[model samples]
Target chain A: MESVGLVPVLCVSVVLFVTGVAGVLTRKNALIVFMSVELMLNAVNLSFVAFARQNGEADGMIYAVFVMAVAAAEAAVGLAMVILLFRNRVTVKLDDLDIMKG
Target chain B: MPTFNDLWLASPALLLFFGAMAIMLGEAIVRPASKTGFWALALGTLAGSAALTVVIFLGPSADAFGGMLRVDQFGLFAQLVCTLAALLTVLFSDDYLRALNLRVGEYYSLVLFGVCGMGLMCLANDLMMVFVALEVMSISMYVLCALKRGDPRSVEAGFKYFILGAFSSGLMLYGISFLYGATGTTSLPGIGGFFMGQHQGTQATLVAIGGALLIVGFGFKVASVPFHMWAPDVYQGAPISVTSLMSAGVKAASFAAFARFVYGVIGTHSAGFVGVLWWMAAATMVVGNLGALAQRDLKRMLAYSSIAHAGYLLMALVAASTGNASNNPALASLLFYLLAYTFMNAGAFIVLAAFTRDGQDYTDIDSLAGLGKRHPWLAAGLSLCLLSMAGIPPTMGFVGKFYLFSAAIQSGQVPLAMIGALSAAAGVYYYLRPMVWMYMKEGHTEARVAPVAFTALAICGFALLAFGLVPGPMLGLAQTSLQSLIPYTIPTH
Candidate 1:
């Protein structure tokens, strides 16, 4: 059985993280931005697992699990906020959230 | 398997967690007509937790939960500050909630849960603990900000905060993973020990990048410049009570974890991030203070003021990098200033909470017009709070600023100290503008003060004055708290 090298896994993780960041910055739809955040978290999980394997320890893997759980909790609240925003303002686009601008 | 000793060590947070759960259960089962019982329970829980934190503060330092948390005087001090902030916030929340017609038992439970997370954050000894605790605190805050669901502005604030908050947490998590790979451990002291050993090439690069990312993540949480765009809008939109707690309690807890991480993980090798922090502190102060000058809304102005205070706190971290660990005036000043900030900042918001009409907070600067003539004592309390914020003499803010700047000068951060002083001086204009309206302007505002909230404000005003006049005992305590971090604080060359 062949295993991936640490450098390659890290590179892929970085690329995925960059993409997620771009999505968060460029995407206007609140739902997409949130999904992008999840993507970033998953990218982190991949790196954590890879690092744990390279280090021959379970700490990073444990951290990955924790990140997943926390992300789910965040999603639950984030989606509720989105729904709440829609209920009040009838829009989910980030641009529409301009009620309290300076 | 955890021992009884571990439970005892962590009981302050555990108590809040259980209290929050009890509130939820009791609210559901009893469905009481009045929320006073629930409010009293929450306040009692916070007071009890604060008392326990003080007892723990008097005890010796130790680690609990297998070194997941350090039970030290430093963390205990932060926990005490957080509990106090939460207590005052709850004391004032009932009236504000009633004024706005927000009837949900969850408000008390969420506040308790949030404070529980803050206590855990102060004591967190591991990177993983910091991340988890941060989310726990932030999620509660997200809901609280939008508790006024009928208001579009409140919902927008909550959504914006959620998106940005979640984004920053992801960035922080990625940084933590890099750090874990670099040091092969999630423990703060373990990372410091790794740096103490030989490290070169790829490992060094990993640490540098990881540390930078971590700072950026913290920058957003504390609402410093470039990352602070969300602050004014969210602060303006959220319910005033939530804003007060978020500004005080969240900032204190986040700064606690940030200070511990900087002193513990990046100890002695402050060169890695000190330069970055220097610029951040400078920009945050200048931008925050200047930004406040243009604001017509009082809430927005205070939000910017809070950002400027974050800058001052970051200056202390910069100084910490230059001096010996145990004797570092920077760390001591940071602790004292956080306590002072929690009081004055929250006290200011309590006064703003008094301006409710038709289920909305009237936070325009004009809303304060003629307050001095109409409500003399309320205006006096607010004036004291504002003076303290402006660094006026015989107030806690003055004493705190003096310590912070002197510590910076002592660490040879003279230029940064000057920038802080100049910006704080500029800040005085906005702080005084409200007073001018309260006393000199002729517009009318029928503000009503709640007894409990007024008492809390009085306590804040008295503490600001008393501590400003006799700061010796408090300064001594702040300095002694640093002793517990000796093992983690490596002496600089």
Candidate 2:
């Protein structure tokens, strides 16, 4: 099998991460914000897998699996919270959920 | 080969995890209308975990689960602190939950699960383990915060916390991947070993960037300044018991893992990181205290107080990283302060939870007016907690702060200590306001107290006084726990 270069892979991962961070900071829709978080996690997984392949070690791959599992759990909880928030406030906008602001 | 000894070493976390599962299964099968049974079961699990922690503490320390976890005094002591906080939360929660009509079987199970995650965090020896354990703890907490389903505030708190928590976790995972790439290993000790050896230029840069990201991640967890925007909102919005648990258990567990990573893995190898922590500590203290002064809500005030306390604890981290690694007084003081914080901060929340009934929380500082006349015991208990939080004499907070500031000074970080002292002084006004409201202000009296919550408050107040008066034992315990980390002599001067 042919080998993929490392710098390009890392560069893509960094782009994905920055995009995710921007989405999270800029987006108002709760679902979109959560999707952004997922994107960031996926970016992390990409880097982990790339590192694992580059080093020819299983550790990074194992970590990637763990991160995926955590991301899944986070998604479950996040969706549940979104449903709850929508039920309580009839809106899923982050700005509208500011009843407890200082 | 892995042996039974490894299981024994991980027994505390294992017990809590199994206990959490058992409660979930039992709730499913039995479908009990009241959560009393689940409460008892949760308490039993925490007690069992605490017992296992003591046993592990008394026994020899060892690596378990292929070095993913370690059984050492440092981790065990943190486990003990977490278990104690969980136990108290369970003890204080039953009536509060019932009062709020939020009692559910899942609450106890989630608390148990959260403690399990905390225990694992304390013992985590690998970056993967830390990430997994942190998620386990945080996910459970996110759910618990929103467990008051109909409350808009609770739902908001949960949503906000989940978003921020997940975002930070992603950042941390990316950082961990970088560290893994640089060191070619995810193990904490391996990372340390790799860093100790001369590194290539790219590897060194990766480690530096990775370390910076790691700080950002933990910085969120500990609610340091610039990352503390979520704390007051979350604390005020969650149920009081959950808030108490978050402030005490979550903070302690995160600090435990953070300390291990900084001291055990990175040691004093990176002066740049120490400088970053120094600035973080100073800024956190100033910002947390200054932000707290504008709060009228008791919970929000306490939230800011917790942030300021995080600042003080971060100072200990700064001292540990900047000065000697092992036998560092600052490190011991960190443990001491966490223990002290667990009691007093949680106790204050218990007092607030005491007044809550029928899904309504009277958390305004003004509502506490005339409580001194109506409920003397409740008033006294809360007063002691508040005084302790204010770092008054004959309180655990005082001793903890004394040790922390002294250690900072001993390490020649006098300016940092001075900033901490000044901010802490500014903090005293808000901490004392509740007491003034209870005693002096003339307002209506409609306060009620729950038996279990009162008992929890009494325990916290007693610990505050006892530890403050005779800090020798807890101090010794904190000092002894530091032996498992890097070794260094306390400076004679």
Candidate 3:
């Protein structure tokens, strides 16, 4: 792993991403889904910071800062929305949103 | 040193940012329900920013912020369109929101914020800037969609929109990562350089993959086919005004920005871009038109129609890539279609708002039955709108379609042009269906307000006819706007 350079690190990020995607996809609970989304974002953040270090450019770090800001905002809105959803459906089931079915 | 060139570069954004602050202040001073002041300030603010954009346009095009944003004719035209749409939205929003008991002070403020984000997005020459500006726009719009909190549909629309929108943003950002991986920079010109400098086959392949991912990201935003699943439900459930905003304002802004990204950077083979977009555009046209056929709900029908129009614009994008952009005039066609679409789509929604009198919105096609007898002027206005949407002659939609088809034929994409015209003919059925209900079917449909901002309605109607019959000037305007965008040379690092 020490011999592995930035490319392998990018691969690790990709692995984390796939795991997160799996979590979001296989889970039924909204909480789990939200956590998976965070996981995905964190993976991206790690990859970005790695790319920043590897490329020797500051844009990746700037982008990481943006990712954090956006992640924080997304969390706030997502949680608020989750609470509202729970209030409406009385259950946190993702499958319950059938009001829009054709 | 902060040069004057940089100051001039930032003027449009500076104008809108300060405009938003001014509106908030005016709201503070005038207080709630001060319709006149809120609207005047809103109009004054957008008009000011638009004027700033025009001023910026007259000067030479250049990049700013270490090559993150670029101010040019393309950005200027999009900013103008978005600001104008926001202004018109504010013009009638007071009455509409007042009627619905949703006229919060923040609505105008959010609208301005959304417009500002949209304007910034139009000028975003960098990847990270695009994401930030897009979020600002999306978050505000999510709030706006659910602003009518009392309505279950409104809340539903907002939640659905938020979830999908957030997901799409992530996907887009993820795509940008792949792009950055390939290019080593997020700037458009930088990416262009990565492509131009790299003679390596694998590097070109990497860029293509990134390009494809980026297309997926944009596909979700623009509600293209396969990415359009959310549009009908969301458009139907959201507020009428929000629907209007999404259909016209958001569509135009996103398309302009997307065009800049694809055309200005990502210098792929014309055929490759055209082929991918061709399949996407054709699919969108078919699916959207087909979906609209089965929808009984007016909002849902228009939603699908919105998807179909997105397809038409995508066709223009494809045409732009192909030889047609030069030979057949695809850019002008696309711009003209966007303008005509703004009028007809928004006019129809205004009529829908007029009918949202007795607690719930009038969603069903049956709801508009005998509207002609009940509300003659509203019916007439809506009829004109529908006809234009159907691409019938002597209406703006027809002229727009003529430009589109002529351009397509000129570009040697005869099949695409044919499909567009045929599907548009199918459009006549749904567009005219409401008219048939209004004229032939028997029912009472009274608008609560007798006056109902008939002036704007009249303006919309007249604009369609005036532009349709005498499209020369508007065509020229569109051509000039397109020309201003033509000199965009992707900078090589």
Candidate 4:
């Protein structure tokens, strides 16, 4: 409470997280869903930065970098899989593919 | 002997890595469709890894990379079991894959990667190492489960596994954060020591919540009760070969970490933690056996059976409760049971693998009909396996169950022990139903396509029988493994 300027940073990060979660929940497009995941990562990054500033520790910054690395790796694999999925099924509409029901 | 610590800890990984490379390279040297050579080399690697693990058992437990990784008797024994599991699985896969016309060179490679992951998990002492190793194991397994991509069910299994696995990982990471926040460190004993100091503080609330969430993550991995919804679908869809590996190799490695986490890290601080775990263990036992009872599909039945066994293991874990400095019979029972459990479960899956033939997998209880008449040996092997799983006398499973219950009783956890015993007794009905189908059915069914590979794994099942009857060496091994918790008490053991 005493280190007063952190409120705006926390609020923005929380908003970013909510928006990302909403986009992932509502979006039907695969690309947009992926974008939402990315958005969530960015929100995490923002929070990490804010925490880094507040805690005056370098760990949060290092964690943000690691998260970015993981995101990149995930993107590479996810995009490859998406391409494979599209090739297997003619269309990419998320709802159109119902071939394998649990 | 290289002081027992030189490079033996990582030799298993190295052997598999080199073996994979050698196999892939050997593909060009061999005639097309010559599957025997690839598997031989793969087995050679696993055997070498197993031997290395034995050598590592001698002495000089080393903490590689400043204790992030510990190579001790506990990890060594776990890796040995994992390697042996992979080896047995490959034996079964040889015939099964051929039957499905799905024999590919990548099978050995994927199996290697899975073993690699399991070994890393066994070795990991740090939280980050555990996560990384888990991902490595899981990613390899995801691909392996859907190796038969032509089958829609296989692909679905892969997707479901990946999604749920990632979800669990995220939950685990979140839990780890709270643990870190509460303890101010990620080292297992550091957290343990931290909890020791702050057993009754403001952090108590966070610690309980975090510990419970962590349990949820682990519960999923072990396929215990509530998080068990995935096992049946995934097990049924996966090629029988992969399922064998998943049931054996994956289970052993997961339990290794489970013991370390519960016994070493969190158990030291609070009674409430162990109390929560006790209920989780109880729920897992009851739900698992009941779920298995309704399954007609052999794979699905075994899947649920696996959950029940996981519950049994949880009993060992419950008995093993480490926070107090009491002599825990539970941990000892867990050790014996895991050894027994591995042999019986892996053997049963082998019989299932044996029955997979001519581009079709036989999984229905009816498929096993007249098996005794059709193929006496295969029927006998499978019957032994099932009987063992049902906790019948003179089998490894019985000893395991007996040890577990006796431990619970000795510990004064009698009601818990009784529940496990009753649930196990109920388990005998479904387990015996398979036997009746294999024996009493009148119709003629085709004999399983007898394969030498499957024969070897069936031999593993018989080995369990021998161990069960005598149990001297195996019990000695288990006790030795249990005794060598040197890494836990001394970081530089």
- Full-model lDDT for every candidate: 0.90, 0.89, 0.78, 0.73
Q: What fraction of the native alpha-carbon contacts across the interface, defined at 8 angstroms, is recovered by model 4?
A: 0.01
Candidate 4 Cα errors over 4 Å, as ranges: A1-102, B1-6, B21-33, B199-206, B322-326, B486-493
Error of 1 at B244 (Å): 0.7
DockQ (Cα-based) for each candidate: 0.90, 0.91, 0.47, 0.23
Model 1 sits at an interface RMSD, in angstroms, of 0.7
For model 2, what share of native contacts is present? 0.94
> What does fnat come to for each candidate?
0.88, 0.94, 0.14, 0.01
lDDT of 3 by residue, A76-95 (tens): 87777677667666766767
lDDT tens digits, residue span B1-493, model 4: 3434435567777778788777766665654586877877788889988887787777667777656677777777888888888887887677678888986887787788779889878877876567667867877787788777667667656655654565565556545544655555456666666665636564676577667767887888988878887888888878888888898888888888888888776664567777877887788889888888988988889888888899889877777773234556667667677767677777788777766767888788888888898788878878888888998888887887877888877766777888888888899999999999989997566555446666665676777788779877776777677665532333321
lDDT tens per residue, model 4, A9-66: 7578668766866775577766666666676667656766665666566756665676
Query: How would you class the docking of model 2?
Result: high
Ranking by TM-score: 1, 2, 3, 4
Ranking by lDDT: 1, 2, 3, 4
> Which candidate leads in DockQ?
2
lDDT of 2 by residue, B1-493 (tens): 7689988888888898898999899888998899898898899888988998898899878889888887789888988898898888889898889889886898988999999999999889888899989988999999999999999999999999999999998888889999988878888888877766677788988998898999999999999988889999999999999999999999999999999888866667778888999999999999989988999999999999999999999999988877755467988999999999999988888889877877899899888999999888988988998888889999999999999999999888889999999999998998888889999988886777777777888899999999999999999988998888752122111
What's the TM-score of candidate 3 when only chain A is evaluated? 0.89
lDDT per residue for candidate 3 within B1-493, as digits (tens), equals 6578776777766776776677777667767655556666767777887788878877778777776778777677777777767765666776787777665676777788888888888888888899888888888788888777666667667777777777677667776777786678888777766655534564566567667867887888899988898898789888888888888888888888788776666524434755888889898988888788887899999999999999888888777767533333787788788888888877787788887764567778988988888788889989998999888899999999888877777777788877877887787788888898999999876664334356667777898999999999988877777775642344465
True lDDT of residue B129, candidate 1: 94
Q: Which wins on DockQ, candidate 1 or candidate 2?
A: 2
Query: What's the residue-level lDDT of B14 in candidate 3?
Result: 72
Give TM-scores for every candidate, taking all chains together and pairing residue i with residue i. Answer: 0.98, 0.98, 0.93, 0.88
Indicate the docking level reached by candidate 3: acceptable
Candidate 3 residue runs with Cα over 4 Å from true position: A1-4, A22-26, B1-9, B22-37, B197-202, B267-273, B324-328, B449-452, B487-491
